[model samples]
Target chain A: MPIRGSDRTSNRRAGGSPQRRLGARKRNQESLSGDPESCSPSDPRQVFTRRYRASIRTGQEPPSQRCSKAIHQGFELEVQLYPLKSQLVLPGDSLTARFIDALSAARLSARNGDIIAVASKVVSLSEGNIVSLRKVRTTALARKLGRKFEMLPEFAQVVLNEADAVYGGVPGVLLTLKNGNAIANSGVDRKNALGDSVIPWPADSHRSAERIRRALNRKFRKRIGVVIVDSRVTPLRLGTTGLAIACSGFKPVRDSRGIKDLYGRKVQITLHSLADGIAGAAQLLMGETQETIPFVLVRGAPVQLGGSYSSNSMTLPVKDCLYMSQMPSPSIMERDHG
Target chain B: MPIRGSDRTSNRRAGGSPQRRLGARKRNQESLSGDPESCSPSDPRQVFTRRYRASIRTGQEPPSQRCSKAIHQGFELEVQLYPLKSQLVLPGDSLTARFIDALSAARLSARNGDIIAVASKVVSLSEGNIVSLRKVRTTALARKLGRKFEMLPEFAQVVLNEADAVYGGVPGVLLTLKNGNAIANSGVDRKNALGDSVIPWPADSHRSAERIRRALNRKFRKRIGVVIVDSRVTPLRLGTTGLAIACSGFKPVRDSRGIKDLYGRKVQITLHSLADGIAGAAQLLMGETQETIPFVLVRGAPVQLGGSYSSNSMTLPVKDCLYMSQMPSPSIMERDHG
Candidate 1:
């Protein structure tokens, strides 16, 4: 569900908003900012915005609660929540159809410059990239490779189907996909689905975005942006954010060069990855195997909507990725093999 | 320079008035939402306000060969480069005064919600948070702590001055600063400055922000935000972003709960950390000691200009930080000792 800042004055005016009652019970907004000592010089007109404020204050009100309450009374914000329903199946036309159905059911129409966050799995499914291991004929080469890697013979076929090329490594092979999306097993999926079924990464995610944007425009008679997003593993952070595999109808990168700072110093090296930020924001809603909300419509983003768009704008060459260079080839090979 | 997208049709327009030429070359047209691929679509006349666009191109285009035969395009942005005038002396009010002088010399004015990015060293200098190793009286306790940890005795004094309280850890301590900014060695500095003088983290960073913001506002009769930024070592990333150690006059945290997805799903986990993004952007301009430009004024940001402010909004508590829990504390301690 979408969380929002509590609009103290408005909630109070409404009289029935639960937040107002909570605010009254607390009578102290000091805890909202976390530290009582720091809030003294803060402008009383400034509104505090946070999600975990309630959770942080429960049973933690200290001796100087009076001052804290006075501080909290000064700030305000309006928060709204939008919760999703159902588990979204990924990587199939059916999944895309389901998303379309959901959008229609909710009476939500895609507006121009509206970014649609589609899960990679759903994109993959729509491309008919699903594999049936039961139908695979395990050749002698497949058996040898499978035995060496401790993988099922049918798994080899699935990997080969998704892979454009393979390079030998200490552990096994390092597979590269057609879109230059490198992965241990060519971006094939085994988890989050039933037995004997594997799913490949979406084919030409950027192309997929364009198609979806076209369909959306046709359906709603409005211009819109499409961001084909995939959860990507960064070198350092655990978990992931949705990276723009492809995009249409928006600029993905923002250059801040030649911009003057507050001190009038010229700024360099300030390219803002707008796509990454949107993808990260979208990732917060599109979870794996949980809350099957596959598509998120982003509104009020800080991007200018409209232009000659291409997904190629956001696609960073594999060589340009600093993190990719850090991974050991042998490790990737091992993951591919076993 | 705030890089922006230009309209394609404007580029094709006939007359080459300076304004029109600028428009054509710069393509500074605002975008309207629509399918990017279609040559012409229904509702061609309809325009929509969009946040993020997909095809905004930025950066300096090498002077086109055709331009040599026609109009010469000067630089797109009005940039004023300011290299440091001299070796800025630290640990005194003179540093702060110099910064203010530089701002005035550059003829930059602060606007409402304009964030001023300042390096930690300058703030450290202003606060007199500097320690001379030569003046330190190393006690038996200092010797013992140093010996136990294989560190210099004077280093302990430097650490003590920077730290408010020592949270338990091996070798070195996890320090909580006076400003409630928790970090190793309280965000102190030893490198790049004069020998034997260690720089402690700024005292009351938020107060420092308030002081600067108020001072500038008084001087210019304009409201502006101030951020005392420090380059922080994150657990994963190779380099650092300018972290808002102190902030004034802006909402640092944005609540995204209740935001709807394209499929009408409510976004639950979308708290956009504005301070971090701004800080990181500022870091691109405010470099290490070499660049010498101490402060940066950011403009054309998408943030709402306001009197509201919070430093707590910029910080994630220890529990909320994903990298902190995952990092090897002992390794960090070992590095500190070494």
Candidate 2:
């Protein structure tokens, strides 16, 4: 449904005084009306809309993009990346409510189609998916593997539980297959954990994302997308960027295998992966370590919406993965391709 | 380096009317000053400053961050992405002048220390880094590989010429190392290329990036950084994000080893690759295709400026690369590591 002016005002006022205190933003947004300056290059919304229209013919966007033919009159088509400042999220807390409240406190309103990107670590912690080193039952195999990657047997035991299969290990890192994604140590991090434990991934990240999306939708009476994000290394590339382990609220990909390019030429091998792209953009502000900003609000990205999405949409079986199919290895792909 | 209000006003006016016509933006900006509501979460600049300061102690940022301890009085710490709408760029065009003109036409001003991200395709085009398939001489090896990947022998010859060494061929793709980076067909793209040809990586991307930076700095009389960006696939992950193939003005990495996290735990094995991070952020707006906004301005990322950097800073030898070291290969790595 379209957002009416009174509806927006009432919504802002209902968010309490902190939201109402945003008089400047509200006033400024209103002042844009009847203003020719809104169409100028200085207006961010105009810039986005202009670029969006120009790129449509180029086939640069996913076909699922919502704003393909939009002239965008008076539309605030701005994609704002807001990094929320939150406290240390501990294990077993209600991450869903925690995020909603924090967003509200940050005065970031949730509307019909806002995406809330959360770091997978925070989701895992909230789900109490952590294992204590003191309570872990480690096997001899666990101990041996732990020594290879400079970890304790307990951490290895937890990793073994979380991993679909352990690929191999070096002195400093171990390659593991988790939720069909190639990750290091199953993305288990002890950096911000309490006492003697580490947080592994939530067993059902897709369901976790769905649950959060549903909760936010119920509370706000509006549809909202949720993406549980993690940082991963790229092949032959340095450092890490955000990867969407799970998503809900839209189709996460644009498969353009036989799609035509701008010149009507068949464009081969172009899949615009929307989820991870948004995650990567969010990761620039949600610093990996102490920037306690696990939550980022990505507004106006032109992504489709619905709660009918799944993790399966983003995963590729090991046997079919291009990186695995071409590599010399004794993993799942060995049986199929090697 | 402190930008006074008068200085900012004069700068806007000097942008020659397009910037001066930003009456709405100027009004909004002025209304923000001395308004207690601006101190709220509604202000984008305040939001950035708060998050930047909050994340500093976590060692999440590069130590040389320009805004490390800055008590930003009133500044716009924004990352503005502008997709330049331009006609097709032919080879040998002065990319430096073209980009400056496009940015100015869009009313974008380059302040001191602003980073400009250029897609490597445009850089290669400007450098005349195209290989005409009609002019190519094919070897037997080229013909053999060409048949494997459905490429003409002449086109395959260009790949051979650009490659440091061919690792082997898969149907539809060939792994080759170009400019010390492992890439598919050595960064050759046929989609936007002239008919019967493809564009490969520039001869010296580092130098290309540096030359662009110098030209921009000379014209603007400001310390501006330049990064030539590319899109590459991640192993086992679908789709691509921006990668910084070459950087001109900053330490593009943030090594967080021996640093403490929020919990005072020693964070290990975390290297915040800033250039690629910024590039990844910029790519979301630039898109892969005809969204002509190939140029993005990444302002307020706390990165230090310097010119004494090279591709070496972002590269690791085949012998040391974890993935390549473990790969089954009889090419460069075998010669370099075996």
Candidate 3:
């Protein structure tokens, strides 16, 4: 049955019917922790967890309960995404400390081996990666890019500055290669920020992720992985899903080479992108709007934790990329180097 | 805590460490059905739920139970994938009935709005979509392709027959576009079957999905969606994730056009591929080995049910495809159309 919703509130962020938006502020929400010392800020409005509230509308067994018996019954291959809502992240705030505080507010503590997915925008925000478009001086190439893509000259300059290589564009969206990923506008975002201001990717995603991982480890006295995530569109697919810009504390790819298949044939080219898959699940919970869920705790993912890897581990070289390798033109590569 | 495994079985299908492979054959596997009349044939080996058993190894609460209280405490946004294992599917079996029986065997009834992800290989097997390499005659082009890609001429013939367009490849893999998806060997599989036989995509994916969806709705007396899925490698990314070959009973894409973003700017190009995301989650559970889990029941996925859509609804036209449209050479298109 469709999860029924109750306690209507005008929430545009969740991007569902009006009835589906059950603002967490009206509910008697409790933290997962029973610690009396736990505290939440004055405004306990958690727009991100509205999906959870929507499940309660029909007064039926929440899906967790419906499958609770399955766990005891010996059926347990599953993955869970918990979108942890927090106070508004401000520039220069310590992400690790802020995340810990958010977990406290949510009453959820970091569990050992949980992979926390932090939004790249928030990472940028904390790292002071904001740029004011009003101060940008557009070059001739930037103006040409603006006219060609139907974007503002200042925005185009920012995109050019961030993108490794620009391929082509539709009106308002440029297809660019950034850090070995084919992303829109090199992962520059205009939404969720003030006027004429934009947030780009963190300067060093791998380093950013490592710092968070170390901090969380120290704070919780537990082992956990960190994945820096950004919303990305798949080629020819609709809507956005999570992409791992950088990750720490795990082998990002599960290489299946030499592994025997069901028929006893050795696997050739199968490397599962563990980080990206986890990121996509987290992004599903962290909606595009002001859901205020910059962190998602992913538990029980089929990943081998306790390893350090670079962000490059998640990206394939252009010569090895399925789409880029197939392109008969060297221009896409030449332009990247150019 | 890492879920530890109790029993040990030599399971190459689950693709994990030895202790992690908790074969389901030894457990008191009771179906979700309390009814004594329910049957699970002679062998009730559910190698798929080994992950669940592993979770129980540490004497800790299963992740599901750990989050159970979250449901009652006004937190509810989550997605759960239940992998259902069944008998070895042979050619010409009725996929719909087989799926229903599998669900019954697991004692998990389908709830309305649950999306059932069926592996496309199983669908192809049931539809008699298998080809015998021994029976095929390799043409000159097939022979050329075989030498170039280090594949059998007979297998190359089959790939050529199934591929919409051919691209460059490495020693043992061919990059091709099949049904608007950039897939290896045009979605043909040589594993899991007897010698010299290969499985390709179902003849008509949309029709296959609709038929399965219709049968499910009738049998369960509940509304549900069906997605035919196949494991696919992402461009430049490692390993295989789920790709939706076809879907029925829902709008595959969530068009966010004209929707306001977090900052109230109208969303331009955000079409969420609900089917693919769900498919990927299901694939994570349905591993590449002989797990015997071809069907996964996904609950509470952020998707709207109740719609009829074409398979084309999930794919982009070549001209509109992000990667395809960026190629500077007309050769790829020419080869495709040729």
Best model number under DockQ: 2
Q: Write the per-residue lDDT of candidate 1 for residues B1-338, one digit (tens) a residue.
A: 11121121111112223443344333223222223432222221211111122111111222222222111111111111121222354666754466556554443434443456677777777678777789987767556666764557787656754555443322443333334444545676654456667677666677777777778777667556666766543311223344567677666655546655334544433455555545544554444433355666654333444555666555554333322222223222322432
Q: Name the TM-score of chain A in model 3.
A: 0.76
What tens digits encode model 1's per-residue C-alpha lDDT throughout A52-169? 2422223121122123332223222211111123234544446446656655543344433356667666777667767889998776756766776566778865676566544321
**lDDT string, candidate 2, B1-338, tens digits:** 11122122112112112232254345444433323453555544444454543433232443322233221222223333444434456788888777766665544567655788888888888889887788887878778877877877887777777777677655666777767677777777766676766788778989988999999989988777888888776556676667788998777776677767777888865776678777776666664653455577765555667646787677667655545555666354323321
TM-score of 2: 0.79
For all candidates, state DockQ relative to the true structure: 0.02, 0.24, 0.15
lDDT (CA) per prediction: 0.47, 0.64, 0.67
Expressed as tens digits, the lDDT of each residue in A1-338 for candidate 2 is 11121122112112112333254344434333323443455544444444543333232452322343221122223355666656567777888767766565554567555678899889988888887889988877778877876778888777777776666655666677777787877788777878888888887999998888888878888667888888776656566778889988766765657655545666655866778777876776676676677788776555666537668777666555545555555332222211
List the candidate 1 regions with Cα displacement exceeding 4 Å: A1-338, B1-89, B94-100, B104-108, B139-150, B164-182, B325-338
Q: Model 2 chain B, TM? A: 0.76
lDDT over C-alpha atoms for residue B54 of model 1: 19
Q: What is candidate 1's local distance difference test score?
A: 0.47
lDDT of 3 at A217: 89
Give lDDT: candidate 1, residue A16: 18
Instruction: Supply the TM-score for candidate 3.
Output: 0.75
